[model samples]
Target: MKIPGLSFSLKRAVGITSAKQKIARATGIPTTKQGLERKIGGAILNAVIGRKRKK
Candidate 1:
């Protein structure tokens, strides 16, 4: 149940986001949904479009 003026997050209380961020930074990977989607989408687009090669 949620009450007005009351906001609580168990993940935030346990520092899950900070831990995930640290892991992502150490591995050079994304730990968030949007970030992962963006990375994958960019890769797909590049594959479809192809990169220009030097002459």
Candidate 2:
């Protein structure tokens, strides 16, 4: 019998996560929400700091 709260990830079982990580690393792009948020936050911080420094 299957558990009510159990789940399975076919992608993880098939190695898709590794492939995505490889592609993200090679292309300098993020494959996850946290990564994308971090990248965007860094860029925004840099832009604001750069403007302050230029003034």
lDDT of the candidates, in the order given:
0.84, 0.87
Q: Model 2: per-residue lDDT, tens digit, 1-55?
A: 8999998999989999999999999999899999999888877988888753222
Q: Measured by C-alpha RMSD in angstroms, how accurate is candidate 2?
A: 5.5
- Candidate 1 local lDDT, 1-55, one digit each (tens): 7799999889989999789989999997898889899778877877888973333
| TM-score for each of the candidates | 0.64, 0.68
Model 2 stretches astray by more than 4 angstroms: 1-8, 51-55
